[model samples]
Target: MGASRLLVSGIACLIDFDDAALSGPPASAVPTVRSGVDLLIEDGRIVEVGAGLPAGTAEVIDASDRVVLPGFVDTHRHLWLTALRALTTETDLGGYLESVAGRLGPRFTPDDLRASAYFGALECLDAGVTTVQDYAHAMRSPDHADAAVSALEASGIRAVFGYGFPVFSTARDLVDIRRVRERYFPADDGSLLTMALSPMGPSYSPIESVREDWKLARELALPIAVHVGAGPVAQRPIATLEREGLLTAGTVYVHANSLPDEELRLIASSGGSVAIAPAVEAQMGHGAPMIGRLRAAGIGYGLGVDVVTATAGDMFTLMRAALVTGYLGAGSRPSPADVLRAATLGGAEVLGLAGRIGSLRAGKRADLVLLRADAPNLLPLHHDPVGTVVSSAHPGNVDTVIVDGRVVKRDGALVAGSLPAAREALLAAAHRIAG
Candidate 1:
């Protein structure tokens, strides 16, 4: 769908906010839905959004019974682990580490990695998630890393390919990151596909090892993502990291459910972001969800579909889990609009992409999703549209998916690739790797 001009006409509800609200000026009022609006997309960007927009010489999409929203952003995911889906459903955090990491990780070949990455990315896009942060921790070799990156590039999804270094890895294994950076992402200037470093955090490795990885990330000037606060050590590791002055704004701490408020404040002041995986954390016995503490500390937090092994990968499930767990923890319900923000703009801020793809502003790349409002589950929408989306809508209701103004899914089906072929590839890879 390159070089196509598409006009989405008569949109029932256009949900977005002003880009100026992101500049940290005096906050404007919350964004509201504009009914009966039309959006004109040309050259892979939204050119106009208002009433009476002409659709001259442009392909038109009928959105009279759909709610158009900026595509959901997933801050953290292990896209290479799609072949292991549902195998770890009954396993908790410890079992996962021992089984998935220790046993299965060492067996994956480069071909397996590529197929899994492709299938995982397609699943995410089908669920209306346009952007993702793929924490690929199974990079067993330089070839494996290259294969994973190539698969993501081929999937046509916007992603941050996090080059993973496990605690058991040697320094020589990580030497290829520089080459990978230079080969794939030579231009460090705001490309849609960027590079990140997934270092083994202090919780899983020694302080010296953590220092080594963090130093490499700083030298490359790339973002760092690490797992923290899932075990019983509490905030001791974070306190030590703070004392050593290793924390920076590029750090993205995951699973901070057990952390105290003081540490959350420290992360915010240090300009770091947090990724809370409610479903995985709850299923795996990580402490109570920290939505209340995170909000009180004023930290920029976003939801993540941590692992497909334990939970669903769709943002709808993530949004619903965040809403329910957050309500239970805070003792006060969060608005549906607020939940949607966490899924979209909040995730963008975590990935440092607030100026680009979070909302449906005029100049932003047209990454959007159209949900069928006439579905039985979404019928009888009398009150808040956002509320119905958060509490009721599922992935099956996704009728159209657009990323960078290209139609990826039309009429509720993917525009490219056969689902059966993708599924067969995943199963074959899993059998070969897990055998």
Candidate 2:
């Protein structure tokens, strides 16, 4: 499908956003859920959303029994780890570091990075995640980093390619941001593909190296994402960052399981965001999940499928896990709307792209997911749309997916060709790396 005029008609439910909704927190405006509406798009942007819109020459998509929503934005994911699926199932984070990152990561070639990134991104798109932050941390060389970027571009998923620098790398391993940015992300305005600097966090890197990396990212005006609150050594990371004047709204702290209350408050005050990968955090023993604490602090947070090696890399699993954990910890159930928002709009805000692709609003990019509400597991419609989405719908219920006004998945199948071949290539890469 071309990026021309398109109309999605007869949507059973539409989770649309208004200016007021984006003006405050996720729950502030209470997302406007409308029934039986049509959305019009042109040039890869939503132009009109309401009832009774004319469908002229535009390609018409029938969504009578489907739910239309902003495509999910996954705030954090190590895409290059998909080849090592379930490799860390029984291991803790420390074990993972020793076994995977220490042993196998350095052995990977540029071809391996390319294969894993391409496969990981397609998995997300097929599962209804249209945008993701590919935290490509295995950049053994500049060629390896370029391979990761090339794979993401080929996959057609909207992404922020996070260039993860290796710890204690020589000066030759450092990224030439100006040169690479010009080659891949030249516009410097807003494009589907953006860039971020993912550095070794304060807990791992020497403070001097951390300062240098932070300064480089800030000078480039790019967002920074780092792992935080994994254990005692990382307690109150925001304070250290604040002392160095490195904390800002562009920073996205991942995991952040059990920081001090004052530190959590400091993050919110400093306009920083958090990305919680609840399933992986709970399974990998990264303290308790921080969804409740983040909410209590009024800090913006979004869901992340941290690693495919340990968890199901999909939004449904992430959302359900977050809700269950939040309830178990806080002794109160979080609103379904809030959870959905975390997976979609909240994730966008954390990535600093909320104004562009978070919700079904006019002038926003046409990244959307259509789920079959009439599917067997999702049958017996409920009164609440958000509740239905959170509790009942699974990735299998995804009927169609659109990114940038292009119909990438139609009738539950990917429009892109040769996915089986890609899977075979991934299997080969995984086998070689494992050996």
Candidate 3:
């Protein structure tokens, strides 16, 4: 009667994102088909996958009308900015900075950050996003960063906590990096909550500061992500970083909207990955990112929602926007399946967690979402399964979600976290900060 209260069984269709795992171009597995597979989860790792299991194994769920998929992994976002929604609706990049830097940046109380981070987290979970890379740049105070992580942990969402500059500034402050490392990177589970030092880069921080941050990241073996692309007015962060020897295997550069062609190859050579938030880039006037060229250059590329300000958290929407817009930019050459690859497995590659999560294989983590193929807007299913997921699916169609072998959502419901309180708290925080 209350929240299924049991283990789940039965699976109708399992569309593995492993469509091109072995053929070369950073592929997923294979055989995306109507699978009558049964999943067994115990102590977190996926214990079994294949035909039916023995009777009375646990609880049984009727999954005949559902299509299962791996939970979406979002590579980048400022989840804590959930409270400060659209403060720059009528402004540009400078305006976004002025508003955030001057007002909301200094006003992010612990409670405010907690509320905002939780609010954003709820949206992602509701839309079937299992993992999010949270760039909490406004963490001026230690409590602020702690609050953000606390909110994420409380939300029961998996995350990579990007320990960034305080108040979104580029300047480096003399803070306790070890404290941050110890707090998030617990020895028990090294993968869940990670500590990544993010600098403001050339524009915000001095070249020395950026380089120092890179060195520290390298020493700690933590991946470094920075804002690149956006435009050509200033030396693009990617080129500047490459020239400075900061672009290394540890670098995970974000954006590159207006980067030159050769720069993509440079990125690949440097062993860095590219994160393309196509929708946010277009809306924010950064022009189109060269996704096709980046892919061809053997650089791992993934999609980002950026923030709730300019894009939705649903990876499907981000993937759809990228598919159509990138095709339009390239005059519709790449197949929609290629776009889906970027969203799922490609993203997994960028995050460096491809083998364990990402796709639905026997040994992979059972992170998946169940979408309703029979929705009125969805109509007849004639197109490619991945294409339909990319172009047509929405959060509403995500009827169920499984993360880390646990049912996080079932029958259009959430099994972790709450939004009403988050919304209320963030709303109050915004008004208080603005006032």
Candidate 4:
């Protein structure tokens, strides 16, 4: 008798979006080959990757003509906007505050928070996203933070539940950052769910208030993510933070879209990472030289699905929109894999969690996406798989999603049942806000 074999389903295309050890971007930025390959996932990590394995000892997922990629990591998203989608798309930043984050944010009861957060998470999961840097910036009340945390917990998604200062205008309206740190941060076990200080930053927050929040994070050694260049664009916060010697690696400067080359070089030199929300930037009149300058500084850079009010929360849209906008605007174009990695590994680096998540390596956590290329729209794989993903694909192509060895989505459906009610909760909130 032959040795017992494990299931080895073959994929027509496999793109490993890691390992670019070269002077510039490698030709195969994401390694690929159009050959029969089967990924044996054991205890969650991919155990083997080759062809012709014996069978019968493991379950099989026949992905003969499908594509596989790492699950997306959304570095910047206002998950609270799940309840207020497109509510203020027509409005400017002030209008956004008054309409959604101000009015709708205040109206969210804890129940409403859970409903929207959990629902938004499910939306991401069903679309094959396994990780999130959720900017949960709409804590109407302190208890709403609990609702936000609970929503991430229940969804089985690996996320940094950004513990934002209570949604407010003046820094005085902000809650005690100290209390938020001590009470709501999920700092146990260094596990999937953790917290980052997401103070509204110097624009919405006073320098004094922003400094206070930074103090709490520094005291706790917690990473902090701050929104920049999305609003008044008055001062380059990166330069300001650098001058104060606060632009350390743990400081993630998001949407530095309007900042120029000089400012970007300063951020890169200061060891701070940047997350460009290109779609939201263009949609909001944030400005040109958005992602291009950030990349040129030899600084760490990533992508994000920022501010769902003016954009969709899914990463696919972010990738496609950014890549096209970037290539069309640049002298040279980044390969699709460079684009993909920006959304995953690049994003993981932005959040300062690169080693634990992001890739499909042996020691990394099992965070991945399975696209059913066997589907009609996915058939006829002509171009590169990574290109197909960022170009031709949508959320519907996602057949399964895994996060930290757990299957969160399968067969184009969310594993959690509460998602429906949660979706309804958002619909109801929109109506109430409208009235």
Candidate 5:
């Protein structure tokens, strides 16, 4: 463990509120934003937050001219596809499937997977995203899974490695999933890494296959993440899952864009959550993002960068997309505070890690981001700090990022891991695979 650190003189958004806060009318919730606040962190957890705390042998980080908040949580991401960025920007879902899944996926080696995962994780950290649920769907072999997990461990970012079923395979077995669990994540030890099962849901798989996949997830006692309402399928996914007795809690439904209100209600009643990738959904023709519907259904939802291959992998872009799409598509205009909560605490709830890493409470893990409030684009530091973050902030405004009591990006540059080496390796792999 390192020395204790104190963050002083910053505007802080605690996001510490009950579920009823979101269910009630807008701005009806208790105020969580504060000014001239300080946070004390030690042993990888927040120790306290108040007006003025004594700095007892701690390193004092001046947070003046900054807006400090809980670091962003990305609920869904295909991190292994980072090297293939912009390859499918002009394509729809089918074209993405053809180019990424059919063409480039098969060409990846374990080294390539490691390079992509490490670089992708670092990119998220640089953008002040402290946590991510990496949907590792490109796992062609057990070696591939191991490579991705090791890269995440080395990157120092909090992550849930969603061990995915092998894509484009007829067998679609869970043999390697069990192996990975026993090897990398034997228990819920307090490490930054955890495991989840990413299986093709009822929409993309046969009932038998879905049954087997769900069985394996239960056997491992892991949470599930699956794609729903992503493309044309034979059956209504949520209804079919309910009918089959497989709609379980702690499951995150990704991209429920085309699902009806009743289906979203099913998710909420069943204690499930949704992960919306607004940028990818709008660009790839999945459907209008289901932000308004999700809010009306009272379902907890989080934003995601589904694939860097199609959109910018930053929460700033994602938040703005969610806001504009919420207005244009469903006539539900979410305030900047609402979107910020979704990006942070709401995302933590979706991943079932709320108790551990969501807010800036005294007991939670110390995952924090400090944005430059004095930046030219964010000047004036208006009365609504969260509004500035949601509307004007970008990755370039990320002045510092700390995850689990470790400073990863400080002074607007990444300080953890070997970024230069990771970049070279990723470029080399991209050349070999995409060429």
Candidate 6:
């Protein structure tokens, strides 16, 4: 846990909205940007945010010439593939599956899983992503699952660890899932770690297996994260779920690149959300990014770094991809404000964590990022902070990052763990697995 700290005298872009406004579309919620404001955090929660707040006993951190905002939330990411960065840059969807899932994924040891997950979480923290939905689908054993969870806890990032079934496994039973659930994530105890069920949906699994997985998720009351519209399954996945009466709230559909408008409407009607990885979809030929389609259907969607194997693993790159592809596909560019909202609050909403970690308001977790306004790429932050962030900013400009009232990255470097050790471990594991 981190000590109480006061961030003062900065330009803060609070992507805040009243809890009553939760029923409205996420795009309709406006942000409140203010200058020379102060935020007081105590006991891992924001206590007050306004002008001339009393610092009292808290350590005052000078946020002078910085742009303070809520930390980025990555809605969907395969953390286990971090060591395989750039391996799929020139591959299509089938190529990716054949190379990674079919070849390398089966060779990972528990130690390798720990190294990849820990380094991946650290990379995210260094890039100012405080919260991430780790769609872990590479579990080979219960030991592998334990290693991944332990690595996330040791890295100090707020994560929803989606307990996924193995990619190539044929067993459809819940024995392993039940064991992991009971051992690691029995309930939502307000810790930094939570759990979700990442199953191969109808597109990849049979109807009977999908039904059993959904039933197990409901029995445990955990959220569901599944892939839809990516593979070449003939039957419509959403329609199949609806026919089986398995569509429910708190489900995060990943890579809905090929899903039609009717399925988008069904997701919105069912109170579900989406996690879009624009760069990956374009590179891997999953299809076009669904920003415009999600907006047209009035569904809330969050941007993600699907896999570092195909694209850069940062929110800034994903934001830029989302902006350009949105314009190219829809013929209308989305505003920078809307895109930034999707990176912060919209991502939180997708992960079912808006109430605790999305916006920088009173009574929310103190997960914040401070960007250096003096960086060459972001110089003269002239009257448009959100635009600068969405258009020009990168990971190098992230000066400080705080998660749960704890400062993880300070002075442009990660401070929570030994990154050099993590890097060496990752390299060793990568070489071993590649061989």
Q: What Cα-based lDDT does every candidate model obtain? A: 0.82, 0.83, 0.70, 0.70, 0.84, 0.85
What tens-digit string does per-residue lDDT give for candidate 1 at 2-42? 44798999998777755565532112125568889999999
| Candidate 3 wrong stretches, greater than 4 Å | 1-10, 19-31, 86-90, 166-171, 188-191, 230-236, 330-332
User: By summed lDDT, which 10 consecutive residues of candidate 2 come out lowest?
Assistant: 166-175
Please give, for residues 203-250, the per-residue lDDT of candidate 4 as tens digits.
455566667667767887788888776345337676666665566765
RMSD of 2: 2.0
Clashes of each: 0, 0, 4, 0, 0, 0
- The weakest ten consecutive residues by lDDT in model 5 span 22-31
RMSD of each: 2.2, 2.0, 3.3, 3.9, 2.1, 1.7
Off by over 4 Å in 1: 18-29, 167-172, 230-235, 330-332
Candidate 4 — worst ten consecutive residues by lDDT sum? 19-28
lDDT of 2 by residue, 81-181 (tens): 88999999999988888877878787678898889889998899999999999887788777888899998988889999988865345333455655566
| Superposed model 6: Cα runs more than 4 Å off | 9-20, 27-29
Which of candidates 4 and 5 is the stronger one according to TM-score?
5
lDDT for residue 160 in candidate 6, whole number 0-100: 96
TM-scores, each model vs. reference: 0.94, 0.95, 0.90, 0.89, 0.95, 0.96
Give residue 369's lDDT in candidate 2 (0 to 100): 96
Q: Residue 231 in candidate 3 has what lDDT?
A: 41
Model 1 residue 226 lDDT?
A: 83
The whole-model C-alpha lDDT of candidate 1 against the native structure comes to 0.82
Specify the highest-lDDT model's number. 6
